[model samples]
Target chain A: MDVRQLSEAVTEKTKVDTTARDVEKIISGLASSSHFWEIVCATQKPFSVVAEIIGALKEKGLVRVDQEGEITLTPQGQEFLKENFIAPRRDYTCPACEGRGIGLEKIKEWMQKFDELTVDRPKAIIDYDQGYITTASVMARVALMTERGDLEGKKLLVLGDDDLLSLAAGLTGMPKEIVVLEIDERLVNYINEKASMLSVPVKALKYDFRDKLPEQYVGYFDTFNTDPPETIEALEVCMTRGLSSLSGEGCAGYFGLTRTEASLKKWSQFQKMLLSKFKVAITDIIDNFNHYVNWDYLLGSIRDDYSFVQVKPKLNWYRSSMYRIETVSGFEKIENRPMPCELYVDEEALIYKPDKSR
Target chain B: MDVRQLSEAVTEKTKVDTTARDVEKIISGLASSSHFWEIVCATQKPFSVVAEIIGALKEKGLVRVDQEGEITLTPQGQEFLKENFIAPRRDYTCPACEGRGIGLEKIKEWMQKFDELTVDRPKAIIDYDQGYITTASVMARVALMTERGDLEGKKLLVLGDDDLLSLAAGLTGMPKEIVVLEIDERLVNYINEKASMLSVPVKALKYDFRDKLPEQYVGYFDTFNTDPPETIEALEVCMTRGLSSLSGEGCAGYFGLTRTEASLKKWSQFQKMLLSKFKVAITDIIDNFNHYVNWDYLLGSIRDDYSFVQVKPKLNWYRSSMYRIETVSGFEKIENRPMPCELYVDEEALIYKPDKSR
Candidate 1:
């Protein structure tokens, strides 16, 4: 009856959380939309997926199926569907994918190394107002760690390294230099402490993007990585710093962007802006690499700004695709829009639009 | 270490058994290969899947990885790869599909029901040399069972119901008439017994597809289903029989196909034949719907054929896409090239080409 519990359980059993939600989505969808049942059956295991929902609802006295296998929903079931199913999903599902764990053998070995040196999850600074969703700690590291020639002995700069990707990079003991530019002094101090303790050559600097790129840091690093705020302005700002950090040709940068907050229009514009201006060709895009924990801490703080704030993440529902970009020429810089702007809005802009229920 | 034991264990944990074989595949492939490690990091739970294989091999001192994460096969791993992996996979892998339980929720529950009515595994006739690979019986049945409008009281004809799809269909108790044309006498008798006892309106007839359509049976059925052999002739022949059985317009048929056995060139030709000649528009093709057991009996029979056949189905690797077709006009008959000849060969013809390893 509790779709959230069933969903998380399904994710553990099947490594597929979104499809379990599809059952509720279908039941709710059925109230207003009637589609050819075969459309639902088009999926890999529609029979089992549908049967689970039907059996659950039947056990709860909410739905029933006759001898002809026609499903009939009780009045109670209809009401439940209407109310609960109205909310859309906040995450994406891609199973057997590299991010979901169907990757190379040595990657598994390296990821275990990253996990072995893992630190406690950093506290989300309320002022930053960013979704602090994290996938497996070692998984975060694996994405960049497995980037062989791109990562090894390459001077790397991570903009707003909130998930501690720098530590992941440091664990490899391969980067020529690793720099962490952070607004939070606590994270900076934390990284500096771990870097020294682990003998990983990582330096953490208290930094903000509103200021111009530090002169010495300009075109200094070979690779940059960031999981920026989903907003285009913030993404542009962080990426600009990354671009500025790139020393020359063959330099690379990795950033995380999500389809939820950034629409196709936004993504198109953002991608165009990155490619056309910076000459950093988008080489690869890995889907659903960074799975997020509930950022209700930030959402709870946003109830004062928006009326439509009844919903909360009941499960790990947010993810960002990891994008790998390489510079073709000397990196071009984004024009400094140096307004000390309130970059993030209320929960509306922060949380992904639930309308795209996938 | 036995890869078979490891693969099944992995399937139990992740509902994905493909990754368990990647180690061997990679080892065998390495002789003629140079690759970036990221390729292996692309599957779900890459950390766990790859590690399992690596750890197993390391325990046996069968492989080694350089500090740079480049893998080098030990002599033992090379020998093992050559011996075991040479036989090639019997199944295909869809990165994150549901048939492996990565599917939607209802489908999983329904598959359980299909699994419950377990029948004794039937013997594969070496002369027939049909791969007795089975998908989840209830899962396959559910695809059509859930199609209430299309199936209820429909006159159904299955040209080669060796997987016992007829039994699954009969469980619906909705078909007005169902007939199976199977050369295997044991399966034919088994279905008749199961049908009579269950009061399902299905008749199993001892029929060879090479024969001309029987007079009473011609143009008598509304729907047809088959999993014809991948050979063009057999597929054409069985489909022609299915076309002949279709009573009139609005008739539909379902069949299973494998991308491995039927190459794109073959698929294109087959599709052209089905569309251009048969006049049946392909309505839908749900991929990886059928997972199969290795036909050891037929493969054992193959000892007289290929010398290299050590491969047992370590996991459910073989999958056939379920194709749904409906007659736009009346189903068109193939120009019958009637010949009294051996229709199918040994496992060499029935199984996929060993050269095309997954």
Candidate 2:
């Protein structure tokens, strides 16, 4: 009956850190939602931790599982939540910006132009683990960049081009130069062709991150942007390349990290790398800022088997938190070293699958 | 005439890191506003760095300074920004949340109730270097806490409550228990009286952060919030005491940090402590999230003589970014050992005077 006693039981049963507050939070999450992903979203906890918490709750007779893996709190659980006075969370986030301070309204014209340019863009290739965010997201990103004083009159290096971010930055006519390094030759050629046609002044080069950055571009950029693969190896490469390109302290970098692909442990490691290894001060991390469109390959991909996909999400639930970090004193450069072969798939990967043929 | 050449000259003159991008950003900042504080906000750079950059630009004949320390671009600087297409940053942030992604609309009713409760609250004491934020800021903070799943049915601790955050949070009727540790007895009495009359479960104890945390409350909280003094010593104490109160991994902490009082070096130190020392993952850092009302003692304070205060800021420019950090596997508990006597005064002390009589 006591929440702390129940929390202790859950913690002991699962061998995971579960606080008295977490027990109530899980119960509150179940009041409106019965699916695993919904609970995860409501609690904002890691997938593994949520799984453990649910398992422990079920064992305690606080919740019951239905035929489709949907979970609902029992009458006993509801009574406990009421006794504790825990209310279900209400959606209070700004609908216009989705809790991101900058909206797409200011960049409406740019989004229209960008939409037209990406009409025939190449589909996300599984081999490269490529998935691009929406055009409105790209414009919002550009707006954020300008707001942070990172966009205007800066040499920007886009570590990948699947997102076509170089074109978006170039469209502002603000950055002095916009360069993109992408392994996909098709994307490189397409971006180059588009840039040349629109006179956006973007240069897209075919470059794999596994290789060392070219000598000419070392410490050449004022800012770098990347949406690296979720694997630890890919993170290291993207970070190293991005750090190596930044000129000095006060230079900035932007990247996107997703909870769907990277666990809280991975997020911790990424933060450690930024703070301890590179010595950059993370200035801003806006959650769910980058929303990805459902890729065409989702139906046949390994993600189809994910528990959350029992009923395909009707909304765009695939999102990444956008991170903006600035150098303080200086940064330590990480070299491009040989990495493990498996950079596309990790234990927590939900949407990405390995290309066996490659 | 070349921007890169000018940037190199500025670097040589200032003996500080300066990039072409910074040069352009400074020029662009001047295109809109001429005051030093306005430029600092516009560029989002460090105080010392902005001072050095502006001095270098003035020496290079790029900007002209008037008697009141207001700066404007010279004709050459204007021409350079125009030729480089460095547009002045436009105000595109959401007016509702001020770009924090959460607005005050949902909490409007709560704000009115909170407003009535604090009608006769004690004014901030200069001896403690205390200043309170707006009521809307407090509510937005509570909303953000709920959004992050940190509030409901939780044992919450307010480390320093000059802002009376305990009352605002108590108004929600969500937190299981609200405990405030404040050195200001007037504030403690005021908060306790309000909470008691409203049937809100809150307890305020007069406790200074310099002393060790009481044994009974250590590791007994689900969340802790604080707005510490700007000095490094205060930061460590607040962090240590807050960490000591957290139950275990997955527990969260919230705090406010400002650029007006802390430089980029201090910001870097704070990040390293969170990531390297305590090993916590910073989840969200919303810039300019907490706006403070101007204090009553500004006329006689040392800040009155600051370069940016010459014009007497017409708007509320004092603000701090809100940080939400979650524990990873575990955190290294920092002991609240003896701290330095001068926790209120530092090299960047802008708003807080040392109170020599003490």
Candidate 3:
């Protein structure tokens, strides 16, 4: 019998016998079998050394080499090795939120600043140790577009191939075709393979997007969705291509980094680039796959008549509880009374409705 | 002129005149009015000190003290002190959860576990910073119970005269009479006064809950809610009384701290105390108002039939992806793949579904 068969036998019997001589005897018995040389070749070990190692492992009770020279793990051996031998080398931190988990809080604060932006519910962006892409991010994207009726048979192109955008494509139920253009050949093959298994007809293309798109596909898509890497020059090139390829009324959803004035300036430059092609309509800053990473969604229309593009901040957009109190009487005593008439030099400066009594 | 009027004048004119003397001239004109002395008295400041301080503030361009002692604010003055001034003090960090916002995350994880065991979404517990007795907290409690179909027409007896709970009674659409039992006579009066203004009828009783609930009101309520201070013995006693007063089919919810196995043994005596009185049908860890702090939710059900008790493990219940590989050998190169078979003998075994072809 072979090593695997002998191991199975020992496990089937009362318990795998772990004696050194017993394992050696089993190995010798298997060596005379018809497939003995093939098994030895597969293990890539010298026959005598393999025999000696098997015997030693058996004596230590790490493994049981049975009558057929088959090997199986002993419970103590498995536990001992697992506990003592292998240790995770790197500490896993959330990649998307940078382990801060403060993205949700930041999103809530941002919503308060703008009037037109509204989220359906509190969505969590989970970071599974090996880099996660959550369903919430996809659902949020779908919800936003669906609420505005933006995705009705539009041919959407996802420039960066990831589970997040793939799931978003599925959830959105729009985009006549989702063309996932991935630069890496291996990733493209993997995504295509997964798509086939999932029964989602996704076309994966391997091409470097930083350079010009293939001449064959220019102005070929309705919308562009990209989460570009954090390089200003690379982003500009990607944004330029994305905006140029869009049909007159198409919207380009770009995921860019946010947080300092420099990032905001980069985002503004992209907006200017879009305006050169189409009439700029509505602009929204949304939480990306990770809520902390803010992305800008710009919708432009060839015609000026679309209501979706004409969205504007509401009248009370700037009002906040921070300025609700008329006066801070002292650090300890915050007076919540109505603002006195004399408190405003210019009546038009009042953001909230004035109390008539005051 | 009073400091308040002077400050108001300063604030009103700051935009037009940025200099201190110009603002002081405006305040001086206002001080010439016959009502200046009356305004000073209303401000609750010593007249002499108020006048001297105004002059000092004017010299510093923090205020504008006019010839007649009236005051107005320059832009510089407004920057220095717009409404009132006080000595700066150190900011305090939240003692619980260490200001990291982990408290709510812990609570949500625990609550999901509780929900699984109880098959009920117990009202979310919120730590409203100062204490549980706040309007927002009460509103949140009532809203949660209402969502669970628990607060409709059932009488609610609030053990303490918390303003927020009283507000909840008024705002909750459920048609139920709310009774407030308070030990403090003044608090009882204040709640009654507010209840009357909102057109909600609430009866306040000067009684101690530590003693048995009044004999007249025994067995009269459907549910009891409390945000009592953290004391294990006190919670046990209150829970006993609350359970006793609950209707035969009614349920009781209690919130408190969670204990790990190591710490739980020390509180084993309390477990026995709870088990003796009520059948703790479900124990859930919940997120209070703060999502980071894990709070234990003990849901005890009163029944005439068999008693049931369940302890739920804290789980971070968020959506995650699960992969099922059809053929393990095809994906063996993948780092996270589960091994198809064990080679070592007698290892704490995972039953392998061997490849039929192999």
Q: What is the CA-based DockQ of model 2?
A: 0.54
**Model 3 misplacement above 4 A:** A1-134, A137-358, B1-134, B254-276, B282-285, B290-358
Each model's lDDT comes to 0.55, 0.76, 0.36
Question: Candidate 3 local accuracy as lDDT?
Answer: 0.36
Per-residue lDDT over A1-358 for candidate 3, one digit per residue giving the tens place of the 0 to 100 score: 1333444344343122222222332333233321332323222222333334444446667656445434555775456434432211111122332222223332332234221221232222211101123333434344333322234354666675543355345433444566777655655676576557556556778866555665545656645666543234554555555555554322334343322112222333433333332332222332122322211111121112222212332211110000000001110111122221231121211111123332
The residue-level lDDT of candidate 3 at A264 comes to 21
Please compute DockQ, using alpha carbons, for every candidate against the native two-chain complex.
0.03, 0.54, 0.02
Which digits, one per residue and each the tens of the lDDT, describe model 3 over residues B1-358?
Answer: 2444545454343211112222232243223321333322222122222333344555666545444433455666545432422111111122232222123332343334322322321233322111222222234344434322235555666665433354454444353667777656665676676667657666777866566676656666655655433234554555555555554332334333221101112122333344333443211122222221222432121111111112221322111110000110011111111222221111111011111221
In the predicted model 2, the residue pairs found to clash are A99-B101, A101-B99
lDDT of 2 by residue, A277-319 (tens): 7767788888878877767776466433334334444556567
Task: Write model 1 residue lDDT over B277-301, tens digit each, in one string.
Answer: 5555454444445666656553343
TM-score of chain B of each: 0.65, 0.84, 0.41
User: What are the fnat scores of the candidates, in the order listed?
Assistant: 0.02, 0.61, 0.00
The docking quality of candidate 1, as DockQ, is 0.03
- Considering chain A alone, report the TM-score of candidate 3 relative to the true chain A: 0.41
